[model samples]
Target: MPETFLEVGIAFAGIALASLVAAQLRFPSIPLLIVAGILLGPAVMSAVDELRLMQVFAGFGIVLILFFLGLEFSVGDLLSGARRKVLNGLLDFAINFSLGLAVGLLLLDLSPLGALFVAGIVYISSSGLIARLIFELQRAARVETGLILSILVFEDLVIAGYLAVLSSVSGGTEEAASFLQPALALGIVAATIGTARFISRGAQRLLERIVSDELFVVAIFAALVLVAGLAEMVHISSAIGALLLGLILAETGHVERIEQRLRPVHDIFAGVFFLHFGLTIRLENIQAVLAAAAVAAIISILGKTATGLLAGRIAGLSFPASLTAGLTLIPRGEFSIVLAALAVSAGLSPLIGSFTAVYILILAVAGSLLARESLRIAAWVESLRRPKGNTTSG
Candidate 1:
């Protein structure tokens, strides 16, 4: 860690600067932080030379990200939306994933599993980016806002299942094909989540006795990490373990205390995670993948657009609002990077990493600009549908 101090320090500095820029621009920080990492990291200027240590720390970053994501929604919330939105979520996954798979196989020349990774990368839209857009674009009060957020919620649950089948207990061994043990992995994840919720029956009584904030932090933090470690031991993804831990602990009704005490730690590690991923990208490598990334981005947008439109129609939204929803769902971030890291661990082509980096840059920047103008675009579309006799003179 001492030798790693320079690399670590530079990473945080990049994170700070990126955050400031994103804040000033009133934009989401994901893209800024990622670009900062790429520009400041080894591939470009060799500012942060070593990666082994940062890789270790970034592990904590991902576990925390997945855990906190789980905390934001509860089991009841998932159950409540299962009937109405589950089909829409499935449609979203199918459309984007199919497009990604075809592109990965045909254009990128990836194998089935690697193509699965690509599909995963394209399947889910960026929840953090979209949430910020909803706020900054002043669409928080709009009806479509709730629909968008609901899609995110549904996607979160879907990913839990997707990752379950996609993960292997052996970490990322290349020979260990993940598809070989779907039943076992899903069984383990289901059992672990079930066990956590079952234990929550008495968790409240235990948590209430921890009167000191410091003690509570230590105790709860230990529990979260311990569950994650144990899950990893059994060949389940540690991230899933962290998520299940959050799901179970949420029922304890102490979520507010846990979030308040631990969020800063989560934020710090999250920055490290994104920044480290950025550093691993090779610019020359990106050039080889850039064309593929561009085509993938276009296909991804079209797929998501179709899903959003069909879902909107099923939910009885107006045509313009449907188009707006489709456009806003164009961006992908966070989880896609996480998937690429997992692929690297699984010994997939290193090109996958560069490919993801380029794809994210294209979508995050282009997608935001498109989302901001989507409403205007939708209004124009609606105007096109108007009758000439009904047109008003300006």
Candidate 2:
């Protein structure tokens, strides 16, 4: 017991130091924290084990992260203007996902399932990282932000379907059984959303009666955990459940209060989640996959930027704003990691996991720097494109 406490304390101390350094350097803390975890994890110090309490914290951290994301926007917002935005979202997905599939199938010669997993890794940008960048950069109200978020929302819904398919593919042996899992998972997701939409108002009123902060927190946490667990049982990711719960709660009009209270908890746990992810990566195996990972990352960066630019243009953003949107969506984080882990666990290929780790690390760092400097970068590109006589005086 004492040893566990000591290990936990040490881990937190290390994370704190990493966070401080990240702040001092004006870098995204997530990648640094993950690097710190890699340094301290089994590949190096092996200071923390898989069975520790940190695992529990890491799980809840992801749940809280998705939950808070849901609070930022409501279902009505998703429905409103969705028709105009759908094309952009679809284009983004089609381009990026196809690029990933090409890399996996043509370059790596992976099976269809393996290529699908690769597509998932490359297709979706890191919502958590991008959201953090939006807050840190203070660009949430920018013209292109809405389009970027709409794309993310669209991706989230797609992921629900993708996970259902992945689960079915991974678990099924017979042809009919394979189809059943995805169908069941999709049905459950649809049912859950339908039910939430139907009962959201009543749920809000009931929640309003709970006046105490302690009870409110407990109630919300319990409900999130329960829903997340249920989702997992149905073969969908628990994060989706938390996201849906947040979406439902957003309709209640108490999102600001809930967000305010959950912010600190979300921060600590989400950090742990990233750190935990880094801990799982085996650095020794990275060298063998470095070339492939680099190629994939380059393709991912270009494809995502193009996708974002197209999406932004479709939404009526200026070229510079569209470029910023593209840069903002460049980082790949949690979902990529989740998909890679699933692939590895299902014995698709160990190399896939190592490749994913390298790919994510590179893009996460590059994306952060790019996003931070997006305005300047965009302006510089625009200046190069204009004729010498068209250059404007400041």
Candidate 3:
């Protein structure tokens, strides 16, 4: 099932076009690319079999995306949050993960591990999607918005922990000391930051003295991929490593330039990743698990909504703001897809894989719409909260 170059080209081209359409329609581009993949891949147009390569590309995209996100992480910002973001994130994770597991066991008859996988799917949300929507809704600077994003960041850490645990369990590796992995992971992060800081500072000097912007950008990507590979070799997730790398360089004078230069490549590869994910979804498998998919979607949405609101209230957000934050966090993206792929590869029942894909698609769409509507509600609430002297009612 090797793909010809032409097939790969067509598949990607279709994705790009579809994503443009999705943006114009104000829909999530990832799902649109998924639709593109479904149409262009063997199940329909039969245009490509390059999914293996696409998978590799997707992995890189995830790593890069995390790295960029990490660059945005600042200890100062976290400390300034009125509520502890980590605790807020943890509360949301615990509530939603537990509910997801309970639903899996009660409704799907899954074993503990399978139930854990289901919980992982529901616990992880698409930060990229949510961030974009927040910006579009003009809610990015809201106090509640900060809380929501912080929680999302913490959730990523939780997802990383779970992934490590799941990988160890599936691999039948001896459980090392609980603290060992986190210690090693943290050590790697610290080292990455130190190195990146040095490079970022020196790189600008080097570039001003000799290197061109184009050459500097190329070197940055090369460093990113190289560091990511090293992190994987050390048994740490490359995503975390890359994030540390980015953070180290975040304070560099070149932050804006580096981000801008990297955007195009990130956008292109990310599209391929989402498109490949969508394309690989087997409609037949989904058909077989439609009942389970429907149930999973409902539980995930409701649980996430409930958890988001609870966590928001605790974080001092108003009801409408809390509700919007909750809805914004419901779409499972890269992490959910990665978990599904891992489950299938680890020989979990095929039904789990099928169920995840269908469930994710359903939730992503519904969750996006819910987030949009919640934003509107939040805006309305904010208006209502304004002084009567400052407002005119229709």
Candidate 4:
């Protein structure tokens, strides 16, 4: 009891110290939080023992992160731009997912199931981390921001289906019941989205009656948790449910109020989420898979960057905007880890987990750094593309 409280207190202190350093260096605090976790994890100090409690906090962090992103835009926006979002999303997924599968199959010689897991890992970007980056960098108003959100929403939708399929695959059952699970999950998500889109106003009116801040916060939190739990019960990602709830709330005019109230809660839990991710990784396992992980990470970065560039262009962004957009999508976090853990739990390959941990660690840090310097990279690329004698008068 006392020991648990002490360990948690120390962990929080470590996170606070890491955050302080990150602020001084003008770096994203997420990667630093992860590093702090690594230093204090079982592989190192083994100072924390309440792993389950940490996971719960981390889970809430992810939910809040996605939920907040969903609050940024209304259902009408998604519906109006559905075509563009869908096309860009398909293109992004086709390129990156294929590259990951190919690398797993040809380069690493993984089994079909293992390769599919790799595809899952590479297909999704870290919405939680990217959302934080966008806020930290103050890029929310940029032209490319909408396109990025659209693509991320699409990815979240796809994950719902992907997890369904993965569950069936993992169970080693070709039975009809196994196939039905994915369908059932997708159906539930579709229904939820539809309800949110059509009946959002009614929901909002009901919510508006609660003028008390304390009660409002409790109600919103409970609703989110309930929806997320329901989604998980259907074998869909709980984050998707939280995101959809945010989207629903976005339809109302209360987004700002909700966001302001939720920001503090989001920060604390989100920090735990990143820290827990680092704690799960075994340093020694990473050493054995370093080369392969490096290869995968490089391919993932390039593939994602290309996808982002193309998607941004499709969304009518300029070269620099597109480049920055691409760079922003390079980090792979929560979903990738979930897929990798799924693979390991299914008894596919232990290497998948280690490789994923190292791969995510590298990209999360590098992606944030690259996004910070995107303008410089964009300028460098633009210079190379300019004609030799194209210097213009100012």
Candidate 5:
């Protein structure tokens, strides 16, 4: 047991160190954390042995992260009919999904289920990371930013539905037995959403009564755990449930206070989770599969770019703006890893898990660079569109 603690402690130390370096380097800490995980994990130095429990903990952390993410968006914004914008988001997902599944089948030679898994990977965009990057960009206040945000919101919905479907596919026996998985999953979602609204009101009263910080923390985590457990019982992603839970709680006035207290805890656990993920990678296996992973990564980027651009155009944006918006949303992280983990947990595909991990690592590096350089791209585009000549017509 002491050894377990020691391994966990060392793993955290690695995360801290790597995170600092990544911050200093202006690179996203995700890949660095994974690299550190690889170093400490059994595959490399054999220093960390309690990987199983760490993975479980990390899974919980992912739920918390996604749950908070869901809380950040305004549900009303989604409900607003912005029909063209909404269609753009859906079209982006559909186009990319089709392209990716085709590639998976033709190039990767995966099974039908494997192909669907690949499509999920390709269709799901990382709105969280991309949104943050957009916020950080100098041109974030420009019209492009608004369009990007709109497109990302649409993409997130696709991801949410994808997650629900994936969870059903992975965990639901009834889903496998009948053609009712989509319908059943939809029913579960409607019930969950409706129940969440009712419970959130009461939960706000209870959360406000807690005076002790420790107790507050306990209650918060307990809520997350309870919601996650329920989600798993119903054959859905706990992260999805957690996300919905956060969104529900977001409606309460006290959400800001709760978030303030929970941020530190979320950070600690999330950092560890990312690092632990890195540690799980088998470096040798990744090396052997590097070529395939790289190919998949390229396919992911191209397919997303094409789909996003087409969606932007369809949404009534100009060609240049649409192209820029599409390019901007190409970065991927976190959600892909979660999807891969869910697949592995449900025994849908082990190969997908291994390959997807490698694929995520590649994206984390390349995507961060592109996101950081988005400002440069935005500036160049600004430079290209010369205003109407001030001089008299020739």
Candidate 6:
């Protein structure tokens, strides 16, 4: 038992070291954290064995990360953003999802269900990573930022539905049994939204009246866990529940306090989640799919770049700005893993999990580096396109 404590403590110390390196490099810590996990994981040096209880914390970490993400925007804001950006959002989905579907169906020749899962992996971007990158890269104030976030919001909403349908599909073996699960899932989403609208004021009142910090934290945490657990019971994603709860709470006007109280908990869990995820992966499986994973990653990157450029142009951004959108949209971390896990759980293919591990590792690093250099890349492209003597515009 003491040995377990020492091992877990050492793993955590490694997380701190990775975070420090990322901080010094002015890089996003996510990729480095995952790398630390990979290095310490059994597939590599086996410096650290899996800590089972920490895995539970990691699960909460993902929930809290998504929950906090929900707090950043409310239901009203999400609806409004979706309304305004619907067309571009649709364009973005059509272009990128089609690319993923094509790869899954044609390139990999996966089963239809497997193909859909792959398309989903290709479709969703990392809300946690990209949101941070925007501030990190100092592009938060740019015109393109709003468009990118709106697109993210759209994906967030869509993913709930996607997860609903996916959960339905993955859980059932019969063609006829599949239809009802999604309907139930959709109903749950609608009901959740309605309930939030009706009860937000009560929650706000309750929150305001609560004087004890312990009571306040416990209440919120309990609600998050209960909703997430119930969501899983109904065959929908717990993440959907976590995210929606956040959306509801965001409307209560205590966003800062909620974040402040919960951020430390979120960070610790998030680090553990990535580390536990790395521990679960077998490096040999990834090696077998190395060629396919490479092909998929290349296409996925190109597809996202094109989608961003097109979306940015439609919104009337300059080429550099459009390209910046493309570049910034590269990293795929949490959502991609979620989708792959679903695929594997559904008995689709072991390949999907292996493929995603390599895919995420490659893109998370590439995406961060690319996003960091977006301005320079866009500048170079603009310079090449303009007449040799023509001044840059927009």
Clashes of each: 1, 0, 0, 0, 3, 0
Estimate every model's Cα lDDT from 0 to 1. 0.82, 0.80, 0.74, 0.81, 0.73, 0.80
- Candidates by TM-score, descending order: 1, 6, 2, 5, 4, 3
Tens digits of per-residue lDDT, candidate 1, 1-394, equal 6757887788789999998998898777877777887888877987887788888778999899988887886667767867777777878877887888888799899988888888888888899888878778898887777678788888877777677667772254545554456667787667756676677778888999999999998998788789889877867788888888888888788999999999998988998898889888888888899999999888888887787788888889988788878888888888888888888877888888889888888898888988999989888988888886897769
Model 5, range 283-349, lDDT digits (tens) per residue? 6667655787788788777776676567766667666666667667777667776776676666764
Show where candidate 6 strays beyond 4 Å.
173-177, 387-394
| Clashing residue pairs for model 1 | 169-235
Q: Please name the candidate that would achieve the greatest TM-score relative to the true structure.
A: 1
**Superposition error at 379 for model 6 (Å):** 2.6
> Which stretch of 10 consecutive residues in model 5 shows the poorest summed lDDT?
174-183
lDDT of 3 at 61: 74
lDDT string, candidate 6, 80-149, tens digits: 7455678877987998889889878876778998999989888888887898899877788998898788
Name the best candidate (by lDDT): 1
lDDT score of residue 322 within candidate 1: 82
* Candidate 5 clashing pairs, residues 3+ apart or interchain: 34-278, 37-279, 67-243
**Stretches of model 5 off by over 4 angstroms after superposition:** 173-182, 194-196, 315-320, 374-394
Candidate 5 local lDDT, residue 95:
75
Q: Encode model 3's per-residue lDDT on 16-59: one tens digit a residue.
A: 79978987998777767777877887667777777777778877
Q: Per-candidate RMSD vs. true structure?
A: 2.1, 2.7, 4.6, 3.3, 3.4, 2.7
The CA root-mean-square deviation of candidate 5, after full C-alpha superposition on the true structure, stands at: 3.4
Cα error, residue 261 of model 3, in Å, equals 0.4
Q: Which segments of model 1 are wrong by more than 4 Å?
A: 169-180, 193-196
| Candidate 2 minimal-lDDT segment of 10 residues | 189-198
List the candidates' TM-scores in order. 0.94, 0.89, 0.82, 0.84, 0.88, 0.91
